[model samples]
Target: MIRKTLALLLLGLFAAPLWAADCSTTIEGNDAMQFNQKTIQVPKACKQFTVTLTHTGKLPKASMGHNWVLGTAADEPGIIADGMKAGADQNYVKPGDTRVITHSKLVGSGESDTVTVPVAKLKAGENYAYFCTFPGHAALMKGTLTLAP
Candidate 1:
């Protein structure tokens, strides 16, 4: 009985992390203006999803800043345009932009930021996108995000 109990405890310990590992993700951005992930799927069981952005490059924010921005796919072009006009002071995101679902703060090398996306804002079968709004970075730093059924 003791041996069985020990096996169960060990199994539980190893399984804990996997069981607790839903609804959040970490994505890395490098100096080459690329994101490590191309897609993210939010589980329908979650009330909110979190995305953490890490800048793995060695540059400063002024030269290679990165931020994660989320919005509907339809809003991407307009958002990127407005963000470019908004510039660095606003983290490249327009102020009071209703199209934005959520976004993280700008991060430089060795820095990180997190954003929480309310799952209620997402709908099944709807197209969603996440991208970096740092000037021309969006061209190479964009990805698709979806609500998983």
Candidate 2:
């Protein structure tokens, strides 16, 4: 009985990490004004999902700031436009924007931030997009996100 219990405990320990890994992800943005990934998959089983944005460059925020913004694909253009009007002090995201689902704070080279999004806010068949709201960066720094089965 003692040996059996020890084996079961080791098995549980090994499986713990896989369970935890399902609800979180990391995305990297660089000085080139680009995000390394173009797509993200959110599992339906997750109650909440976290996105960690890492700026791996050496430039200052004024010249090369990056942020992670999430919204429906149809809302992206308007959000980006309005965010530009909102300006840098607001992290380029319009204050009290209802269209935004989740977003990370503006970050510059060597900086990082994370945003948590509730899975319930997502629809399985709808198209969602994520982008950096820093001025002209959204043109190249955008990607698709989807809820997965």
Candidate 3:
């Protein structure tokens, strides 16, 4: 019984890291108006999560700017519409938009920005989406984020 318990403890120790959650990720946006990742799974163990957006292409913000925007999939249209009105100075996100859960600043080629999302705000079964608000870029620069069970 002592030997069995010791072996089980060793196994548990080795497996602990696997069960631990990763609380951050990096995503890339390019000149072609594309995002490198299509889906992000936020681990439930995280109290908060950080997403880093890197603009990987060679273009200026005026023409190929990219920013990370997060909201419910149902709220996407309204957010985008308001963001456009908010204009570039606001990083293409409306000021104080309640629909926006979190967002990163607009970035150009070789630039990057990060956004922190409170895990408490995410619902496991709800559809959450992330996208770029650069004019007309949403058609391609978009992805889904979900809270892990």
Candidate 4:
């Protein structure tokens, strides 16, 4: 009975991390210029969080490229504008944008990328926004993100 109880305890211990994995999330982009999710929550308990962006469409990057960019909602417009100026070679992001908290590399259809954001930089009450910086894609590819209690 003791051995069985210990085995169960060990199993529970191993399963704890899986249950606590609210730190990572996946977002999908399609040819239609849409993101699968409109909102994302990052758990405060995590020291860092990861966002994986996947392009499910079949279009090539040049015609329909996508990238995940994170910043405060207020900073989005300026960032997007600057990103546009930076153009495609820079993944539609300014080369040294301090406003960008984290961003993934530009990706094409059937491709994916991940960006890691440090939790310490996130404020609980601030409104955070995430979007694809592919030229004019921001209008249809934006989403909100928040820090969870």
Top-TM-score structure, candidate number = 2
Tens-digit per-residue lDDT, 89-129, candidate 3: 99999999999999999999899998899999999899999
TM-score of 1: 0.88
Off by over 4 Å in 2: 19-21
- Candidate 2 lowest-lDDT run of ten: 15-24
Q: Model 1, 1-115: lDDT tens per residue?
A: 9999999999999989776639999999999999999999999989989899999999998999999999999999999999889989999999999999998888999999988
Candidate that beats the other on lDDT, 1 or 3, i.e. the better one: 3
**What lDDT tens digits, residue by residue, belong to model 2 across residues 57-118?**
99988999999999999999999999999999999999999999999999988899999999
**Model 4, runs deviating above 4 Å:** 1-4, 7-11, 14-19
Q: List TM-scores for all candidates, in order.
A: 0.88, 0.93, 0.90, 0.92
Question: Between candidates 2 and 3, which one is better according to lDDT?
Answer: 3
Candidate No. with top lDDT: 3
Determine which window of 10 residues in candidate 3 has minimal summed lDDT: 132-141
RMSD of each: 2.2, 1.4, 2.5, 1.7
Q: lDDT of each prediction vs. the true structure?
A: 0.94, 0.95, 0.95, 0.95
User: How should the candidates be ordered by TM-score, best one leading?
Assistant: 2, 4, 3, 1
CA shift of 11, model 2, Å:
2.0
Query: Lowest-lDDT window of 10 residues in candidate 4?
Result: 16-25
Candidate 1 lDDT score relative to the true structure: 0.94
Residue-level error in angstroms, candidate 4, position 29: 0.3
